[model samples]
Target: MAAVGGLADDRALLGRTSTAERVSDILRTRIAEGFFPPGTRLSEDSIGGALGVSRNTLREAFRLLTHERLLEHQLNRGVFVRVLTVEDVEDIYRARRLVECAVVRGLGAPPFALDGIAGAVADGLRAAAEKKWKGVSTANIHFHRELVALAGSARMDELMRTVFAELRLAFHVVDDPRGLHQPYLERNQRILDTLRKGDAAHAERLLADYLQDSLAGLLEVYRRRVGADG
Candidate 1:
């Protein structure tokens, strides 16, 4: 009986850890992968029951994502996935230009991690060619994310994460992952090549233009979607 009780307790502990981590991961992945549409309400009870967790555990997960800006809390209404407005998208791109351009400029020589960036770009291109928009989008983000990480600033990395999440939510609403990101794969490659050539200034300029053009294209799609839906 004692051994059985001990095993039960161990199982319970494992279950709790698994629930919390799974809740967090599911929320993040769905948000990133565009499964959870923006402006959609997320009910703690419903989500918890679906994931086989307690409401308390689900709330903890909500709190974490709320901190990440992927979820927003209303005074009494509850949490909803963040919706990026046109202004929000513009702000995100503006910030990206400022931070990412600085990151490239600061790296005097290409870091060894340029190989990883190249790999991510290649993967994104392949995904685009194969018409796997989601895969391409993920790889596209990975490419910029790795570039930002090259600067080696924890704070910058965290900021980039928030920006990236917002962008993903925007993609979810726009709903043409291919139309939005596929055209940019080769641009990403060019930027990588410039960095590899140790042309930090040129890379910075290219990234800024790329970000602007991409943001403009995405905003057009978003506007059309909003119009059609309305």
Candidate 2:
């Protein structure tokens, strides 16, 4: 719903070669990036036409994402980005704590690669300065992704991509982006600092606490929103 009309220029991708998986990946990333937000109905015709992919291909992509729980296909209503329940939010944080904390705990040595994490932190700082709340959230996500990348596993990265994409669904629900994400800017820095000191245990604890506190705050708001609607 966030303006898929301008995709005409992307026709080049089709000429090169397009597949259902690629289409799904693009949409998934768009969803994760907060472009087409939660509850927005995806127009098959508009998206397929724009991406220069066949309807069948696009539908397959939709099917894949639906399986991922990032999109839900309704009966004759169309595909809509999923709105996470409080339960979904809790589950995502649970996954974050398990994987992210373990990654921090399993660091091999001093002078671990902190470049990616550092860059993400810097990006967050810059976005904060510019008052780009969405950018800040994205940078936060990047920081975690880089953190997971420390585990040196492709499967882990792939899994977390879906996890983070799902987490973005929760993010789109909140009205105050700054309120949801601003406090974490400093927390992200602290985690990075802890890692830089070669203190894996300390970093792991920081990450675990960060996840717990984040879950608490997000649940509070999500409950209120859903309850108000109910």
In order of appearance, the predictions have TM-scores of 0.84, 0.89
What is the per-residue lDDT of model 1 for residues 17-115, given as tens digits with 9 covering 90 to 100? 667767987899888877788888998777887888888778878888888778889888989998867777778898898888888878865443687
Best by lDDT: 2
lDDT of 2 by residue, 119-183 (tens): 99999999999999999999999999999999999999999988988998988888888999999
lDDT of 1 at 9: 58
Candidate with best TM-score: 2
lDDT (C-alpha) at residue 89 in model 2: 84
* Model 1 alpha-carbon drift over 4 Å, by segment: 1-22, 110-112, 227-230
lDDT on C-alpha atoms for all candidate structures: 0.83, 0.89
